[model samples]
Target chain A: MSETTEDIMSATYRALCAHGFADLTMQRIADETDRSKASLHYHYDTKEELLRAFLDYLLDDFESRLACEAADPDERLDTFVEAVFGPAEADDDGDFAVALLEIKARAPFSEPFRDRLVALDARMRETVAAAVRDGIEAGRYAEVDPDDVARFVVTAINGSHVREVALDESPAEARRLVEAYLDRTLDRRSEPEVPV
Target chain B: MSETTEDIMSATYRALCAHGFADLTMQRIADETDRSKASLHYHYDTKEELLRAFLDYLLDDFESRLACEAADPDERLDTFVEAVFGPAEADDDGDFAVALLEIKARAPFSEPFRDRLVALDARMRETVAAAVRDGIEAGRYAEVDPDDVARFVVTAINGSHVREVALDESPAEARRLVEAYLDRTLDRRSEPEVPV
Candidate 1:
């Protein structure tokens, strides 16, 4: 990104963090960047256009950081969980989660926002599903539908983030809970031992 | 509730469905109600105060509808699932899910909103936990931590709602996956037979 685009992106992030997606405006971003409104208009003609770019920036960064490749499928799954549930792992994500959620709330209304978020979700699901498929092939996990497993994992993780941001519950507890459940559900043994 | 409060709440719902939480204004609600803005102001001095009442109204209705008394724990669990996962069971919730999510997105920034949502979560956890405890006592479910089970269920359900609204995925699918997991994990039998 050019310095100007970089400055605007940072400014947008700050503005989002400060005022939230609902109250954000080009003027607010410009104020944060210490630049003229004309500077904002010079690059992006509208707030929606600018925010679309902002969402792309955040999602690209997230895809790279949270969904990296691993040698083993189990390792890939662990990496995804650790990256998501581990606090402060995503470059001050705690502060940005609310803002990100606010943008998602608008997804129902804005096709551009909706499409971007859908791509993000699809990418994350594919990442997790690929891990599950690899795990199955490697005999690390039992033979379960990879897409089903991935969808469940992604859905639960998505819910965990919302709970974390809205209800102040940690994804770590969710991680522990899901891990326990997955341990039993994904068992390759013919019989799952019931706890006495 | 008084007829006036009912009018305001219905107005709030329509306005939310039409404009969503971010753009909601008392004036817009008044327009929806076909009532004067003065009437809205007479009841709610500020939009924040009105929205607090709105959240209370929504949570109350949801509590009564989604979390209800059941004779059996399994039935209770099923009931909760049906209420949340079953489409259109929560009275046009399909229209309101996105709007409700928008309210929750603001919970991080608003104490009143956060408090109400937190209460909602606690109440749900208790309901599910109570059912699990009952199931254990009745020899219907295996010996397991009820709260742990309940927390997992609730977390997954919360996550499911976010996924449904943001990603257009169905909570019904999440329900199926969670049910399969719970069926194994909550087994009372000595062994859980594996399909493969």
Candidate 2:
């Protein structure tokens, strides 16, 4: 992202965190950055436009963030999964998840938002599938269909996160189950030392 | 549900499927039933109120439908899972799922919606847990934490459904993965000969 875009997105993130999705206004978003409302509007005309830009920024940021340097396929997959399930990246207060879910709920009605979300999920699914493919190629894991495994992993995490946001269900249990499933099915080549 | 309530719910279902959630109106709902808009208003003062009632009906309907006559634990568990994953109950075309997602997305902002969604999930979890418990009791499956398994199953289904609604992802793959996990972990005694 350009430096200016990054600055605006960071501010947008803070604004979203503070106001929640339902109450977010472009004015509030502009207030988080050095940009005046006029300047913000100059860059992105409408709140929907700004949000679509934010989603693009999010996709880019996620791709960059998932560039894990783990040594093995299993570990790489674990790291990828941990990026969401782990504390460092989880939307702790659920404000962010709620915000995303709200957007997701409306995606059916908005083509641009729908496209970005689809792209984002595609990235996640492909990244996972790549990791599984590597494991199979290296003979470090079972020869199960990589795409299928990736879909299952992604689906489980998606469900867990949604449940956590919607029902206040503990995501810790999901992490445990997912980890166990991976270890059992993949035959862990690198035992994760991450404490439960 | 009473005859009157069932009539209303069926109408509500048709309206939701036709209009989707965002455009749903009491008038549209009334158009689906014999009841006049005034009569509908007498029953539910607001669209939100009517939706809440519909959710309650859904819960009761779900509970009754899950009284699966499948003889064994594994078959019974499959039956319950099939309620969502199977063709018979799967929300084909996803209009209903999209509507629900819209409601679920706003659940955090509304207590009544949140409570009903939580209750619905709880019922799904407990039903799966009970099936697993029965399986263990009969020594037809390897012992595992029934609640844990139940949560995992529910989470995967939720994720798959959400993905299906939001990303137009296929849910058939999710069912395949979930079934494999259950058969492998639970040691299925009743071999489901259902064609995949």
| Model number with the top lDDT | 2
Per-residue lDDT of A46 in model 2: 97
User: For residues B1-196, could you state the per-residue lDDT of candidate 2 as single tens digits?
Assistant: 5788889998898888778887899999999998899999999999989999998988887887788877677667877877777653344377788878877877777789889999999899998898899888987778888998898899999898788777877788788889888887777745446877
What would you estimate as the lDDT of candidate 1? 0.80
Worst 10 residues of 1 chain A by lDDT: A184-193
The segments of candidate 2 whose C-alpha lies over 4 angstroms from its true place after superposition are A88-92, A189-196, B87-92, B189-196
Model 1, runs deviating above 4 Å = A1-7, A31-37, A66-69, A88-93, A188-196, B32-35, B66-69, B87-93, B188-196
Mind giving the per-residue lDDT tens digits that candidate 1 earns over A1-196? Answer: 7898878998898888778787888899999987899989999999989999998987877676775555776667778777667665345657777888887777777889888989988888888788778778877787888888777777778878899889988778889976775566566443546999
lDDT of 1 by residue, B48-162 (tens): 9999999898778767777655687777877777766766534565667888898888888799999999998998888888988988898889899999988888887887888
Candidate 2 C-alpha RMSD relative to the actual structure: 3.9
- Sequence-dependent TM-score of model 1: 0.86
